[model samples]
Target: MRTRAKLSLSLTVVAMVLGFMVTLQYRQTLLARVSDVTASYTDGRQKELADKVAQLERVNKDALKRLQNLNGEIAAYEKESAGADAQLTSIQQNLSRYRILAGTTPVEGPGISVTLMDGQYNGVGSVSDYTTHDWEVNYVINELFTAGAEAVSINNYRVVANSGIFCIGPVITVNNHRLVAPFQIQAIGDPAVLKGALEMQGGILDLLRNVEDIKVSAVKVEQNIQMPAFTAAVTAPPSEGAAQSTKSSEGKQG
Candidate 1:
């Protein structure tokens, strides 16, 4: 029973990760297409880009279909195992924990939200200085996680283990999804603790306000905050060395 339960959980996690990775890849492809669509592109180039986008759309659709099938299969297995009350409950509890860790589950609870915006420009030395940087956003996220934030989001984009925050011109991309100021960061955790972490003296708020010159608003504690599951891939791309090692291992097995 233990072995079967572990196997089922492992398979489900693999399926969820693959689905997210496929979605993330599709989003990245779209971002690339957007970047490629410059005024300098010729008619032929535009047509080629359109073709690639269409192909990717089909791929994304197929991946979603597969994920749906996998979910159905898992559901059927759960139904079959429901007869074992004690074992089933234990399995379910473990599954729920893993789902949260994998970020495949949406979470809602009492938490806090912090809003950051660009400071007012007074013919400033550099506009960037008054704006929020990706690192600053990440700093807040890191702080939240350090303070026991179970889940976090920025402008409704779920921040998972593998989520990246980087600047693209005036915008920041999370999970390859672009967002602009003011960025509202919401986290699911203890309201007071999360709020205190951000509002503490010389904390994230102080650094953003005094050093970064960002418009840092008061952290609002809420009784209920909803954060969506990470829809993009949680797995980081394997390094070249790791890929080569896997290939060598496969060769040895063969």
Candidate 2:
């Protein structure tokens, strides 16, 4: 009886071990099948993405080629246009310069140039000239323009553009540059019209001529003066994008 019981227990243990082994092998097969399906799906997606990338690259290449062609066409057009207008522009510019250099242009209209200098002072009751510093010069420039001079310059430097009527010590500043006495002021406008607008008629010019008097000359010169170049002028386009960015380009190109 004892032997039979031991034999039964041994058989039960073997059956249980075999059942667990089969269950583990089935589980492994299921995992392998799932892995194969997942890998196939991933490979399909990767291939699709690669094809899409290839299409986009082709499109970008085509766009760049078109841009280059358009740029070449534009260059040809500008060359032809510049050739057409070159002679006219040059002729006009030469004429303007010739007029200026001839001194036919008037230095002033009807404005006064009051000069102030650092020299011997006239005593009390003695009506003499010569007052120094930046204030006097600035006062005269402003007054001249206010009195109807279209433009004013100290020496050759234009005081109208980014120039200050400031002073350092005895010298006056015109466009940050120092200028000494006997400053030549050039203006272009109606001389007679400006002369009537002066605050102290003969006072400014007369002071330079007589009292504390320095040499200050004001005469109306006919204005054939040429205007200066503007800092921001229209410029040529830089790149394909630049041409495409403008309204004019769109209208013309479209």
Candidate 3:
């Protein structure tokens, strides 16, 4: 009986020890897993913060660069403005002198109204000898200048020496300016001379009618046309007035 009791006690003790060892091992494993998770979370958070800081730095750098560029641009614009104002003052004084010198800008009186429409003459195949709007305008302007026109305008767009005429599809531009036709050309000169140069009864009119069958109209009228004076750039100084003023000052001193 005694031996059996001791054997039962030893068995209980062995079971308890086995249970304790198992609990300790489980606790260590759980602690290791929790530690790994905490480290990973901390690492992820740190990386996120670092990336945000880097992005902010980049944005700040870009903003600073933009601000510097804008400041530089503002300084340049102010300098340019000052120079332009000085130039403008110098120009206004000179223009006053030119107006006096020209006595009067050219005025339109008793001029002919010449209309040159698009040419349409087909020779062979489907190809027609139709003149484009450009050709007609060019030919008319050239003919007008040859015909001694002081000034000319097409569709009220002034045809100056430095005028720009460009074509985009069916539309035509004058002075980088667009307009729709039929083109109205106003030439300020002797109507008789212009008419003679264009369609002198048996000149270009007869030739166009017989050769190409193109139509051109020239009619004489007593009328007035005036072209606006171009805005002058500030380079050429006032010649006569300044000289006169200087001479008058000299005379006064004498």
Candidate 4:
């Protein structure tokens, strides 16, 4: 009976030891599983953060490219605007010069004036022979131009490229207006040069005094000579289509 009791106690101790070892092993396995899950979650979070940073970098790059394109467009527009302003200024300057040359604008400068009259009634020839003819008036005008006259007028009638000078039944007609002697011929130029040209030996003045037996006063240099714009009609009548268009516009306004 003592031997049997000793065997039973040994069996109990062995069973208890086996139970403690099993419990320890189960706890260790559970701890290992928890560590694996935590590691996986950390790896996923790191990957997500990296992907987000890459996406932001791409967005920033695209935005910078768009900004560069916008800057280039602005520079091009500024250059084009500057070119247009310069072109407009050049066109205005050319138009002003053209208007001056066309004699459509008034002018003022220093010049010379001369008076011409019929020869003194020395009863030697016909009355018409001693009279100042239209040709003689034209001759003086031609001489003034040859002397570098910029503008000229007779009795305040501005002489232009299309001006007409002829005789209308014993009366001299300049631009269709009657002009009698002592014809006042005014020219705009350098005062000294004009005087020199006309008063030169055997010049227009000398020829008129000797050959034509006409009275020509000394050239008078003026400090200021005002010339009016050509008042004669210049523009032609509008075409049929243009006239209709103008009429239509007027009707609309009415």
Candidate 5:
């Protein structure tokens, strides 16, 4: 009986130890499973964050491309605007020069003034031979132009491209305005050149003083001479299309 009791006690101790070992192994396995689940959840969260970062990078690249394209368009527009401004400036300059040449605006510069007077001689000669004529005035004007005169005026009346000069009996008519003796012709040009040209051998001055016996005196070189604008109505030459239209209207009226 004693021996059997001893063996039973030993078998009871072994069975308790085996049960404790089994319980410890089961708890360890449960902890390992929980750790695996936690690790899997963290990996999933990291993957989600990485995917969002990749998507943002793609969006940023697309935005950058669009911005670059907008910049290119803006640059091209600026270049075109600059070109248009330059063209407009050039056109304005050309128009200003044309207006100056047209003599529609008043001009002031250095030039010379010529005064022609009828002879005061009381000799036996016709009155017409001693007095100034329209031809003499025209000749002086022509000479001034040939001597590189920029502007010319007779008795303060601006002479233009279409100006007319004729004689009305004892009076000289320039631009339809009557001018009497002691004609003052103001010309804008190099004073020396103008004086030299008029005083040259057998020039207009000589013809008036010697041949016609008219008194041509006093060529004053002035530093500043102001010329008025041509007040006469400027008639523009009709264009071909306008002339044709006018003819057509006349035909219809007829």
Candidate 6:
């Protein structure tokens, strides 16, 4: 009976030790599983944060590129605006110059003045031969233009591209206004060239001097010759037939 009790006590002690080992092993397995889950969660969180950072970086780079493009566009617009301003200023200056040349604006400069007078009627020839005609006035004006006269006036009347000189009876009309003897002509140009052109052999001045009934004189050079602006209403263009009739009338009058 003692042998049987000793064997039973030994079996009980062995069973208790086995139980303690099993519990320790189970706790260790549970702790390992928890650590693995925690590691996976931390890894996932880090990956998500990294992806968000990369996305923000891309967005920021795109925004910077767009901002740079906008700056370039603004600079180009400013440059274009500056060029347009310069062109506009140049155009305005040219317009002002053209207006002066068109006689729309009054002008003053150094120039020459010509005086023409009718000789005393000696009763030696026809009345027309002793008087100045519109053709003669037109000829003198044409010569002045050929000599590079920038501006011209007949008896204070501005002579523009469409100015006309005609005769009414014995009186000569310039710009549709009656102008009597001693017709004064003012021209703006190089004084030396103008004087030389008028005084040249067989020139307008010389031809007038040769005529027994016409007297010609020139100022040669005069400073500060002011020219008034053209003030007459523009005449409409004449039809072909009307132009022919007018030419025929002028010829007969001449």
Leading candidate by lDDT:
1
Candidate 5 residue lDDT tens string, 1-254: 99999999999999999999999999998887768646665787777987898999799668656755774575566565556587765765565456547665567889999888777644344545423466788789889989998888878877764544552211233444355777888888899999888889999899889998778877899899998655454554467798778877896774
Winning model by TM-score: 1
Prediction 4 global C-alpha lDDT: 0.71
Per-residue alpha-carbon lDDT of candidate 2 for residues 1-254, written as tens digits (9 for 90 to 100): 99999999999999899999999999988787768646664787776887798998799668656755764575566555556587855665555454333322223333333234444443322322222434456656666666655555555444442233452222233444344555555444555555444325665555545664444544544435432221111232366776457855666654
Per-residue lDDT tens digits for candidate 1, residues 1-254, read: 99999999999999999999999999988776776656335578787887898999799768756765775577577667765698887886577678777776567888999898878644334545423456788789889999999888888767864455552212235444355678888988989999998999988789889998888888999899887667666665567798788877896784
In lDDT terms, how accurate is model 2?
Answer: 0.50
Per-residue lDDT, model 1, residue 21, is 100
Whose TM-score is higher: candidate 2's or candidate 3's? 3
What candidate 6 gets wrong by more than 4 Å, as runs, is 1-85, 121-131, 167-177, 235-254
User: On a 0 to 100 scale, what is the lDDT of residue 29 in model 1?
Assistant: 85
Error of 5 at 95 (Å): 3.0
TM-score of each: 0.59, 0.33, 0.38, 0.49, 0.51, 0.51
The candidate 3 region of ten consecutive residues with least summed lDDT is: 122-131
Q: Which stretches of candidate 2 lie over 4 Å from their true place?
A: 1-133, 161-163, 167-177, 196-202, 227-254
- Against the correct fold, how does model 2 do in TM-score? 0.33
Q: Residues 119-224, candidate 4: write the lDDT tens digits.
A: 7654345545423456787788888888888877776656654444542211234444455667888889999999999999988889988998888898999999
Q: Assess each prediction's global lDDT (C-alpha) against the native.
A: 0.75, 0.50, 0.58, 0.71, 0.73, 0.69
Preferred candidate (lDDT higher): 1 or 6? 1
Q: Candidate order by lDDT, highest to lowest? A: 1, 5, 4, 6, 3, 2
Q: Can you write out model 6's per-residue Cα lDDT over 141-185, one digit (the tens) per residue?
A: 788888998888877767764544552212234444455666788
Looking at model 6, the pairs that clash are none
Q: How close is candidate 5 to the true structure, as a TM-score?
A: 0.51
Error of 1 at 190 (Å): 0.7
Please list the residue runs of candidate 4 whose C-alpha ends up more than 4 Å from where it truly belongs after superposition: 1-97, 121-132, 166-177, 235-254
